[model samples]
Target: MPHQLAVTIRAALPAARVAEVSELLAEAGRKGVAGELFPFAEVTGVHFARLLVVPEGPPGADGAPVPASVVYMSEVDAPLQSHLTDLVRKAGEGLEKVFGHCDGYPTGSASVAARTAWLRAHRIPSAAFYVNTVGRGRQQILREARLREAIEEFLDQQGAALSGAPPSRIRAAVQEHVRGRPDLAWARSRPAPPALWWRIRQKAHLVALPVVALFLLPLLLFALPVWAVLLRLHELRDAPGRDRPDRRHLRELAACEDFGAQNPFTAVGSVKPGRFRRATLTAVLLVVDYGVRHFFNRGDLTGVKTIHFARWLFIDDKRRVLFASNYDGSLESYMDDFIDKVAWGLNAVFSNGLGYPRTRWLVLGGAKDELAFKNYLRCHQLPTHVWYSAYDDLTTATIDTNARIRAGLFADLGPAATRAWLALL
Candidate 1:
């Protein structure tokens, strides 16, 4: 189940404009593909909903409207998100082409008031969604009292022209008398209203501040206790038996073993032809213990439930690697020992020679299995790749060979580390 984000648009607009914008919104809804569109007309106003599916979980199953987590408002009879503003602008351009010019004025006051009410209800973060009615360019200066008078007169004469006057009568009259230019023709214009600065200020003061405070308060409260625990753990780092053996020393010992003339496990260059490669690259490491399970389970099962580890490795030009280590049991009893040894081995290899060859390590659990590797990349910040696959049943020989290639064992480290690591050899 995926979480759903619902957005509602409310506006007072001419029926034609409302229908036009709604059609565009419906088109966008279809393109989103993951959600549904519902339009409702109330006595007070008209509204529509565009629901977006998020990957977490289904929002609400019942027929009732899902409580909106985020809202967007636009003056043109539709609610729009920041990402959809471009589409709205394109639609407006289409309208201008049909109407000749969209003078910044609303076609009707009811529509204007409805839009204002909707914007106020949503309390969007910015005013960029609002239309600018004042004409753009040189004629913008003409948008003042003089232009309003001229436009009103023009509309009046146009009404008269519809009452059986000659076609050229209104055109000649407008050009010769109203416009005072024989060649110029009158085009419809809609000048945008002045920007709503005071409303923006009020939103910052009333809505933004409170929301910001609410968001920060929980973080501050949780961080204090977590920080205290971390400080206590930091104090234990220097305690007895805490002095661990450096990995570089262990690698020296490993190097003494006659594996081959070519450093079999070194990250310096490509691995020897017959050597095995292990997939140990990881991005996130989730260490779960009995206590964590008990906390969630209310003292049901004991020991270790599952140890999940995520790794992303570049296998070759052909494929990318994503794997999870699913070890069942108490982490302290079995998994910790494995991690300690593996970390020692990895540290020895990397420190003795150079940095790790793999790109990233992801430490995560709970729902890692549910994620399609490519889909995960789409929503996450991991580097891009052409293809990804799960390597759950990889053989030891294949795994080791792939590891060597992916780890860049044959590649030389810097001169300093290479000289040091290979010095003993």
Candidate 2:
């Protein structure tokens, strides 16, 4: 029995016109015909319409729906079920016709004839019609009525051919198409075979394989020596037997150490408590605790050489003298102690150097200790600079120096420093 698929008309289509289209679908289902109603909305603006109908039941069942499928109400008066396998095959042709006469009346006799021939060939049983008349006036109602009459006449003529088909089969076919079952649609739209060059091109990468190998050869050759040196350095630095070295290790190991020996008041490593005998002009860097010791050991300073306990000397180097210390102990108890001790010692150093040479002090505190450092600097009336260096070129610095660093000096520096120290580089 042809499946009796329920037909519905939605959108702004009139009640009478919708009933007429639904009656045509009901009659088609009773006569064992199978097809779809291209909703008024789908066909009204379109120059042509196409639909696919498949049989219901288990896969490979005998007379299981027309695997060949059908195309109904296309602009071209093609047969309903030609051996052509896929609806997509004729989509471009249909779209061309739809967009070609975009503004014309859609329900003329010539249009009706073409639509009837396509529907008759497809043997559609049930369909839902929808019209979107969001803006049209009374003229749209008349056009829909004419379209309904034409579609009913076509269904009536194809009634005899649909006689033996079960209504259930028709319903299932319509459901499958509406739900977009590609497997059922696949039999109708058999895809063309791949081009000959497609498979051959997959192997073309082999031809460029040698060139890629050659390009990487020089990089590998150059990288080997540098990598070996770095590996050796890593091994020496992290050797297992060595004692855990402290901040003074580097400075103690090097000979001819010059931590402000060139000028008075300029010291690189920790300074002990003592006054210099000579008329000194240098910056004194006092390392208070272990944290400050580590800051001096960083690569930028090379290594701590000496801690002149007494005299603060000033140097004539173009670069600013930075005194950095660390605060990593207990925040509540030792924090005030650390700040007071460090600040007093730094003030003394700055005061002693003021008479001889100009100097700047940089305190390196951990993330948690920044607040304490800021409060201490604020209380002491010492000029302070804040630096934030993070991912990419997001490094920033704000200096409280009376004189601003010149732009020309920063431009001479590399791109990284220029961006990082935009305020004072």
Candidate 3:
């Protein structure tokens, strides 16, 4: 469901400024991006743009999140390879679109064009990619227990095989392992379905919509004042963790209890598509949790950065599941944490119709749930993304970036936008 891409820009730019530049690039063209930013930053504008920096990673000096390279990952229905590079090139060109100026860097339009040419000529040296079609019964599969365990085990194995290895290794191994599997091949998103009764039902609401709007007129009058108070209250909250006011994450790493800490790695997997009803239900749940998830997670999660997690989930209209998450721990510890803390929860909510294992994961729902999840794991194996980040702070916090200053500017966008922005972190 998600077509992903990563390009390491070995530019002349310093890592700190590079991080800022990357943020700007990510924010470019997403006129529909919901979060607040300096009106000049253009983040709050809403438009149909795909592509975001996945879990802005690669910490630079002073604990700043300077990714080793800028990554442009998107969940677009279109073929990413065809246009993502171009979009990224365009993002690199329009400095004003993301930031407010073209000062402080050599990223002028001509320079950007030159850099784009350089990228094309040199070719991307290494990259990690994971994609699969959302199955027809993805939502239902996500709910299934037995199937979930199988999927997690497979993912874990995949990780193990490549953990701490080179990107070339991942590419070589995965290609070989899944050689016979046609399911994971790149493909277009599911086509639009024929209109159903839901359309008629939605049309019927047109008459009632006017009545509802009339009734809410009084509330609309008071909306601004109410919004003003909330916005002020939001300002009072602590700024985002991007500033690295206190690098608990760095401290955690220094004191990490695990023996022989693991290298940074990303794990990506997807579930097959599903029927329409499952798609509908998943959409409702996604909307419901948008705000709730945001309010609860304000900073690099205050201290969770110790694990150095940068993850996101995507469930499309076809009930396709695309999960991308990374962490700083050995395969063993990561798997242990998953089974102990995340497995059950994954099956419960995140899976949607992705289906068991591919969708559910761990399938360790309760004391009564089977231990099949454990059975699927081959601890000896490593799990690594196409390009496992040797950069531990690849997505860690940084002091160089100016995100903290702009965070408060975004405070007025409300919880959903906040949550959406956090997903980028």
Worst 10-residue lDDT window, candidate 3? 379-388
What lDDT does candidate 3 reach at residue 182? Answer: 55
By TM-score, highest first, what's the ranking?
3, 1, 2
What is the C-alpha local distance difference test score of each model?
0.27, 0.27, 0.34
Off by over 4 Å in 3: 1-273, 284-293, 298-309, 313-319, 342-344, 353-371, 374-425
Residue-wise C-alpha lDDT for candidate 1, range 279-349, written one tens digit per residue:
11211111122112113222111322232211212222111222112222321333344333344322322
The C-alpha local distance difference test score for the whole of candidate 1 amounts to 0.27
Estimate the TM-score for candidate 1: 0.19
Minimal lDDT window, size 10, model 1: 126-135
- Highest lDDT among the candidates is held by which one? 3
Error of 2 at 1 (Å): 83
Best by TM-score: 3
Q: Residue-wise lDDT of candidate 3 within 1-425, one digit each (tens)?
A: 22123222222344455557554543432332322222212321111122222332323336665333323222222232434345444445332333222223334445545544544442332212211221112122122222223333554777766577754444344334434345422211232321455335434654564577689989868885764464344323413111221345333233322222334333222232224334433543443233223322232322234332233333222323233334445545555656555555444433333222332122334212324333223211112211222222322232112132123222344555544433332
Q: Tell me the spans in candidate 2 whose CA falls farther than 4 Å from its real position.
A: 1-283, 286-335, 339-344, 353-376, 379-386, 389-425
Give the TM-score of each candidate: 0.19, 0.14, 0.29
**Number of backbone-clashing residue pairs for each candidate, in the order shown:** 41, 52, 46
